[model samples]
Each structure stands twice: as structure tokens, then as C-alpha cells.
Target: MAASGDGISKSDQLDSSPSSPSPASDCAFSSSQSSYMSNAPDPRPDIPSPLENGSMKHHVNGDSGVNGINGQMKATKVGSRSWVGIYESFLMKNASQIASVESTLQHLTYLFPAKFKDAEIASEVVYSALGILGLYHDTILARALSSCPSSAKYQPSLHTRYTRHFTTRNSAYRTIAYMLVVIQKTELLNEIMSRRHGGQRGQHTAILGIESIKATCRLALLRISGTRTLVTPPIPERDIDPNVLDQDGPITHAEAAEEDGDYWMMPRTGQKMPQLKGETDVTRFLMKKVLLPDDVAPSPKLIRPLTTADGRIKEILYILRPLVYALLALLAARLRASKRFKGHYEKVVINWMPWVVGFALEYVCRDGIIDSLSAEGGIRAALTKITGLEKRELEKRSNSMWWWTLRGQFYDSITKPILDKMIKKAENIPLLNLVGLYITDYQYLAETYHFSTSTL
Candidate 1:
């Protein structure tokens, strides 16, 4: 029993010992378990390690930090520019105004009918004044744009586009100025004369005389103010063989005497033409003693632009048409004023047909509709192929003719009628109603007389 008690006490003391070999083994096992948990790859790979997360964040922050530094450098450089550099951008260039101010005002006339309505004299004065101001404006703006370095290369093309041939260039201005004379003969003239003279007229042709002088002065100004002539396209100095001139140089004095001023002897309307400046002597001198096969060559070879210059023959109607209308109007007025004539005949005949004829003549003459009647084709088609005009360019010109529905007589005859019906329908539509109702002023304008009852 004593031996068993001693063994039990030894086991109890060993269990209660502070530094036992069992405890040390247990400590080693616990440390190994903790190391295994830390070093082993986790089954949940979805949860990233704190070290991996920190590495990814550092990489992203590094990229963002570089970008921010670059942007700040760029901003500092731009912000350093001086105010003088900013001002020089706009200040160095010439200030300019628009060239189409007159056309714009005319188009806008429908917006203010009351100002231009029955007051013919007032309207004429206003339109003429604005037209003059616009001419000066165009002149100044042209001076400005042409002086610019960027636009200098395109100056010639710009001039060609904006300027017309010599004959037709001033057609509109000339017409307006001349109308200033006859415009007084219409309602405005009659009203003024009647108010002062009280129908007891004693041959008051002095007003006509004054207007004629004024018209002459206005024409002189137009001649002085605008470009007088265009530079005629460079003509091939000689188309004939070199030795061909060795054949003949006949005296053209007789023929020249008979010819008025058709200096270039171009294809013309046979009407006496004034000597326009900058013409080339293309008389080929093929009228030699011994004629070559080339001399018989009758190609319709003329300057490209001059081919259409003859179209100015019809444009002369600009000057003649208005004068004719004015004279006819004066006759109609006289007939109305006659004690023998009275009611219906006067109203229908006096101002009615004159306006229609004049308006039609204006478009027909100016827009080359008359020339289209005898357009150059077949034999002349080869000759008419203007330089620099390609087949595609010509096709573009042909296609653009479809846009003529918006201009000239086509507008009066075709476009306006269709637009009238469409306008009413458009006015009924919700969003589109604005286009037809208040936006366009010409939709309801009278076709016969321009600006309602105004003569011009």
C-alpha cells in the first residue's frame, strides 16, 4: 500500500511542475500549428492578402500621381501667357463689315411693310440710301479681307465670285438710280403734284428734267465707285503657225472705221459696243495675202468669260426696260387725267400691266433666261468648255440649276404657287407652324407689284 501511495504522489507532482518536458513539447506543437495556419494557401482565395491589397493600391496611386503632376505642369505653362499675346490675336487683323447689307435689307422689307408700304418716294429714298451705304461697306470689307495673309491667295477667286462682268455688274444699282426719276411719276409723283398744283397743271416737265440730271450724276458715281472692268482671261497670244504672219498683214482701217468700238471683234449682238478696257486684239491677222488652212479655221474660240459677255446685250434691257415702263406709265397717267376718260379703263390700264411687264423683264434679262433660249451647243459645245471646268464641275452646275426653282421667274410661276398651299398646311402643324406663319414674310406678298403697291 505504501509503494502505491508514493507512485501516485510522484505522478501528481509531475503534473503540477512549472517546467515540464510535456509542456515544452506542447508549446512546440502549438507554434507549428500557428505557423501552418499563417503559411498555407487559404481555401478562400476570394479574400486577398493585406500585402497584395496594399501593393495594388500603391500601383494605382503611382499612376494617378504621375498624371496629376503632368496636368499641373501643362496648366502652369498655359497660364503663364501674357495678356498682350491674347489681345494681338484679334487686334492685329483689320475689323470688317458685311458686303450683302443691301440685299439683306431688301429681303427683310417684308418684315416692316408699314415703313415701305404706300410711301413710294420714301421707300425709294430709303432703299437707295441703304444701297449706297452697302456699296461703301463692301468696299471697306473687301479692303480688309484682301489684306489678310491667309485670304490673299484666294483673293482672285473671291473677286471673280463677288464681281460680275463689266456690263452686268452695275445693272441693279443703275436700275435703282434710274427708277428714282420715274418713281416720282407713279402714285408718289401724282400725289405730290396734285397736292401742290391742285389739278391745274401747266406743263410741269421741269421735275422730269431735274430727275434726269440726278440720274446722270448717280450713274457717274456708279462708274467711279465700283470696279470698272474685270481682267479678261489671258488669251493665247497666237494660235496660228509662227510663219503664218509672214503671209499677210492687211490694213484693217476701213473695216475698223465701220466697226464702232468692237475692238476685240468678238462674237457680238451686232449692236454698236462701247470700247471696254482690257480687251485683247485677237484679229489673228489671218487675213493674209496667202491664206493658210488654219486661216479657214472658224472655231468659236473666244475668251471663256467673254463668251457669256455677249449676254450683256440682253442685260441692256435693265436700262431700257425701266425707261420704257416709266414712259408707258406716264402716258397711262395722262390718259387717266384726261377729262374724256373716267373709271374702269384707267384703273386696269394705268399702273397694273406696267408693274407686271417691268418685273418680268427684270428677271428675264438679268438671270440669262433669254440666253438659255439660244444656248451654245453642238458645234459650240466644244468651244464653250471653259478652262478649269471639269466634267464633274459641269455636272455640279447642271444639278445646281434645280435650285433655280427658288429664284427668278421660276419662283413666281412654279415655286410660289406650291409654297402657298404648303404654307397653309404647314401653319396647321405644331412645331412646323413657325416656318410658314411669322418666319417668312414673302409667302403672302403680291406677285404683280413688288412691295405691295410700291413702283420699284
Candidate 2:
């Protein structure tokens, strides 16, 4: 048990292995060393073996040899699987259905972060996003574009952000081709034109935000117009009768049959060919000027003089006739309102004058030709004479049993007889003097503000 000079006890020296050591003592020493090594960190720090404390092995700042190898492997596996299924599903859908799938993919793409695993997959994403906003189809494109102006007003920043991201001219030709194939091409072109005219917001931004959008729309418009998609169908030939005489020209038997055949051929033919016969005074004047006299034969030698006279008369009637009638009517209305004409004269001015004037106007407008005028014209004959209204119309009025029952006989006997008597009385009155009085009274009234006169 005594220590030797080399600082080894005699017992330790005897226990040391020298050529052959005792196996039991060596085994006991190795077992004690193994027990001490159990609490130390592992030599392989790259693997994610749990720490002695049972905590996850962190990748950084380790006292050990390495870190994060297992974490890197896990991330690689996840990233590899990311977007793989999305890419496969996206490719299987058609363009119309792609929009719905694209929305989900976009959300996934945002939620699950990963680099595009393949170029084809990236392009498919781009294509799907474009389709979601209807960039690929014309009908949907129109709806999208039409709604853009409104969206630009509210959430303008967000609107601009997405607008610039989506719209590209690479599919311009394809878009135009699709729109042309639709039967409603004209309506679609009109919608685009109206959108252009309606104006767009942010169109002039320095970023060319809406301006670039308008340019794309203009390109589509140009494509449509250039292809003549807006061209209307050709009008079919129509049968125009050269010998038609007057506003109420009689239809010949053969002409009527032909018209019936045409109407039978095309049900909507009458809707296309509108008739405006004598609906206006200008039309009436033109008709009269163009129509030939039935009593006189058309002579080429007299054509020049007749045309000049007809034009002169038409101009005079178009200008002066309406003015003269307006003036007379105004004078009659004023006279009816005057204090002197309130009682007995009120009836004559209000009721009688209008009836007489109306009848006279109808006669002049309808049968005022020189040949129709004769010296033997009396009040009774004038009342009985045919004018614009036919006898059939008068008979129809007389034979209206329901109207007679509803309105009573006062309109038929009293009102009609009085109106006829007034017409007869008004026939003898000189129209020249009445016109002169109107002019004189008009002048006197105009100067009344300057001087008091007994002209009233």
C-alpha cells in the first residue's frame, strides 16, 4: 500500500496491465468509463437525435459538430410535393373551368410558399389567373371590362394593382377571333364602342394604368372594324310605283294583288317600309308639288314652266300659308277673349269662328286647286262638297250607335246643325278684310305701349 518514487502506489502498479493484464480488472475499468460517457453530447450532430434533456435538437449555435440536416431534408420533401397536385389538376380543366380552379390555386400559392417547381407549371398558373378575370373569352371579357370603370372608382389602388398584372396583348388575336365567332358580334362591338365613349378612370396615369387598358380595347375595336364585323346585311329590292298619283291614290287591282303577295312572302315587310302619307304639312306640300293634274295631259313642252310655277307656289304656301293661318287663328282667339265679344259675340268668336275656320282650312288644304274652284260655289254646295274627308267617314260617324248612345243626340242634332249654320254664315265673310284687320290690329297693339289708340 506504500507509494513508489514515480508517484504510483504499489497497489495501482500491481493492478496496471504490463504484458498481460487481469481481464476482470480491465473489464471493471472499461465499464466505469462507459458509464461516465453516457451524459455527454452525441458525436453525430447532423441527425436529429433528441438531446439528453429530451428537447428538439436546434440547428444553430450548437456546441455539437453539426446542425439542421434533418430539418433541411424535411423542407426539401415538402417543397417537392408543393404545387405538384395543383399543377396536375390545373392542366386537366378546360378554360372555362380553369377560372374556378385558378382561384383555389392562387390561394394555395399564397398560403403554401414554394418556388415554381417547373416552367410549364408556372405558365399554367399565369394562364389560369388571366382566365379568372375573363381575359381569354370575349363575352366574359366585355363583362369584366364594363365593370372595370366602377371598380376603379372604389378600391382604385387594388384595382390598378390587379389590372396591370393581368392584361397583356399576347392573346389579342385570339380574343378578336373568339368575339367574331359569336352571333351577337354587332352588339358586342357596340358595347365596346360605348365603353370607349363612356370613358375610363386612371386612363391618363403616368403608370399608363387605364390608358394601357384603353389601348387594348382600342386594338380590339380596330380588329373588329377592320374585319367588317359591324357591316349590316344588304337591303333587298323594293317595288316603287312611279304612277302613284296622290296622297290617297287608289290601289289598282293588280298592284293590290302584288302587295298582298309581297306581304305574304315577308311578314315583316310592312314594318320595314313605313308610310308617312300626308302626316305632316311639309309632306303634303311636297306631294302636291310632285303630283300631276288629272284633268290636263302632261306636255314636255310645258314641263319647264309648270315645274317653275309649282316650285314658286310650293315655297309661297310653305312659308306664307302657315303664317297667314296662324295670324288669323290668333286674331280670332284674341277677339273671342275681348270684352266686346263676351256675350253673344262670345259664342260667335269661340265656337262659331273656330268651326268656320276649321272647315275653310280643311277645304283649302284638301281641294284648293284652281280647277276645283268655281263661281257657282255657295254655302250649301260647299258644305256638301267632297274634300279631304270621304263620305264613308261621315257615314261612319253617323252610324256610330254606341257613340250616339254614350254622347246623346245633342252632338248630332244641335251641335252639328249649329256648326253647319256657322260654316254657311262664315262663307260670305271677306277673308281679305279679316287678314287686313289682323295686320292693322297687330301693328296697333305693338305701338299701344307708345301711344293710346281707339283701335282696340
Candidate 3:
């Protein structure tokens, strides 16, 4: 009555055997036909009727009455077998589809761009893919996050490996740079530092990270001033190249003085060559006429002696300048933190605060210390008067206001543009003090040892 695992029914066998009788020929069959039917044995057990057996079977055996029944049973089994095969095939196909979805999700998670004009749309695609993947392979994503590096160096690796795989129009460098800061990946930070020593690209990444670091420092300073809601992030360890030196060699000095020197008569031979008198005279003439009168000349006036009063003022200015700058910085940072400002405008304010404070301090120092002292006169007055004149001359010589102005100009011309590029590049990396950390480590080691020139 029921089919087995092999999918064949007992009734199916009986229906196909030959020499079986037809249902309508029981009473009127010819003698020869009757004899043939009687001589053949029934393949199936005899039953009272279809109701008794609880199933029906039609004998085939060239029996005319059962022709349609045999055909139908045969067709049904074949069709059933085909349907089972199709179902199994569908299952296997979907298994492969699941794997593909998982692979796509992993790639998307690692390489998702921070900013996109169609970010919501892209995110939907990513989410859908990830959701499908997670349904089958959640462990894969967990493992990736677990294995992620903590240092800054990994940020570039991500930029090169993951970000490039995504949209070509966006910056992979800035995206990973932001992630490195946001995620606070120390391993990635170290990797970034190491790369910085490699080539121009690495150096560029380092410089981008440095801007973020300075902003974080400013924010911290602001918080201390009670004007900012955000606290200053930790300072990163600085990487100081031990080989950097203050010393100048003979060749360096010569090159620096080259504009005034007689190039035509200068050594045109080996390391040391004969010096012509005519060339020496010409150089002397140029030095007096063209170079000496210029700021480029090496003169005593260019090298101001550091006096006790000057040092004291320097200390005061340094302290007061940062204090005032911190206040402004905090105010700007608070605004940013409050979400009242964002993008390029927020950055401009943050960068401008320090320069503004420096300018204000210069104005105060010049007018209060130098100008005020010179106005009071006597023998104690004469010395005070002389010093005040010298101080004012030095102040004028330095063009302190001009220096601040130039600094502001530099911020606008160079720093801001570079910062804009960096911000776009570094998406939302963790706040790791990349530059500070490198510099600190270098300074620490340098202080721990005293080295000879050969050792260096």
C-alpha cells in the first residue's frame, strides 16, 4: 500500500507483469484467451476488491482494460523521482549562495567608506549582505574584529588592502586614518609610525595623523579652561630621529653663503681647490654691497644675546600665551563638541585660536615691557632707556606681529587645506595620539643614553 525508501510500490510491480487478465473480460472472453489467463499465475495476492486491499492495481500484461492505468503509474514514479532530485539540487545551490553572501559581507565591513553621497544606499546593501551572511557564518565576522590590529600602522594596511577594494572616488587613506584614531588601535598606530620612516607616502600619512593629534591636544587644553565639553585626548609617544642634529658642516655654511660668494672663482676642482684673489675680492664686494645688508647675512645683530630679563619675559609669554590660547581653544572645541558646528568651519576656528593668542601676547609684550620702560627717564633711567631701546629694536627686528600674521597666513594657506584633505581621508578612526606617542618614545630613549658621534 505504501512506497519504500527505494520509492517503488508493490502495486507497481503487479501492474507491469504480462499474461494478466483485463477487468472487463471476466465473462465474455474467448476460450483461447480464457485458457491463457488461467494458465498464467497472478503476480500479486488475490484480494476481495479495491476496498479490501485498501489500494488498487491494474495488471498490464498486454491486457487491454489496464492500458491507461499502467501508463499513469509509470509516469507518476518518474515525475516523483525528478521532483526529489530538483529539491536536493536547490538546497545545494543555496548553500553556495550563502557562502558568497558571507564573503561579500566580510569585504564590506572591512572596507566601508566613511563618507558617501549615497552612503545610506550603500549601507543598505552592506547590511543586507551581512545579514544574509550572518544567518550562516557569524563567527567569521567576530574573528575578523578580534584579530584587528590596535596600532596606527594597520591603518595604512587597511587603506591599501581594504579601502581600495571599494569605491575609487573616495580616499582609502583618510578613512583608515579616522578608524585608527577612533578605534584606538595601538598596533595600527605603530605600523603607521614605521611606515612614516619608509617613504613619502608614509610621511604623508604621519602628517595627516599629526593634525588630528594637534586638534585633540587643543581640545584637551580647552577642557582645562572650562570652555570645552570634550577632554583632551592622551598625547601619543613622539618618534624623534636620533640623527637629527643642530650642527652645520663647512659645506652647509658655504652653500648657505653661496649667493654672496663669487661662483665663477669658487672651487671648480677637487674637494679643496686654489682660491683666486680676484674671486675673493669679488665675494667681499658682494658681501658688503648685496648680502651683508640683507637679513640673510650672518651678523651679530641677527644673533640676539639672551639676557636675564629677556629670558624672564620669554617664560612669562610662553605661560600666558598658552593660557589665553587654551581658553579660546576650549570655546571652539566646546562648540564643536556640542554639534553646533562641524566640517571645515569648525576646523578653521580650532586652528586659528593658537595663532590669535600668540598675536595678542606679542602686542602686549612689546607695548608694556619695551615701550613703557623707554618713556621714563634719569642715570638708572639711561640704562633702562638704553635697554628699552634695544628691546624695542629687537621686538621691531623680530616683527612679532608679522610672525603671527605669517603663521596665520600659513594656517590658511597650507595647514587648513592639508587638514581638509586629511579629514576627508581619515573617516572615524579612534583618537590615538599618533605623533605624540612617537615623539615621546624617541625623547625617552634619547634622554636615557649619552652617545658619541661614532655611536650615533
| Highest lDDT scorer | 1
How much is the lDDT of residue 183 in candidate 3? 29
Per-residue lDDT of 1-456 in model 3, one digit per residue for the tens? Answer: 122232221111211122333332221222223333445444344424343453433443435434454445445444545554344334222433444555676566433333445332354456544543342232221122122221111111111222222222335423433343342323233323434366534533443344345445444332332221111111111121111110121222334345455344435543332233566554633432331111221222222233335433542453345345434544654565777666887677666765666566755554333332333452356344433224434445345344342243354566446655655455454543443343333332222211100000
After aligning candidate 3 to the native by TM-score, how far in Å is the CA of 360 from where it should be? 1.6
Give me the runs in candidate 3 sitting further than 4 Å from their true place. 1-315, 340-354, 366-369, 378-410, 413-456
| Candidate 2 wrong stretches, greater than 4 Å | 1-322, 365-456
State how far residue 330 of model 2 sits from its true place (Å).
2.8
Q: Which residue runs of candidate 1 sit more than 4 Å off their true CA positions?
A: 1-130, 153-315, 339-456
TM-scores of the candidates are 0.33, 0.17, 0.22
- The RMSD (Cα, Å) of candidate 1 is 38.0
Q: Positional deviation of 418 in candidate 1, in angstroms?
A: 14
Decoy 2 TM-score against native = 0.17
How far out, in Å, is residue 317 in model 2? 4.6
Better of 1 and 2 by TM-score: 1
Ranked candidates, highest lDDT first: 1, 3, 2
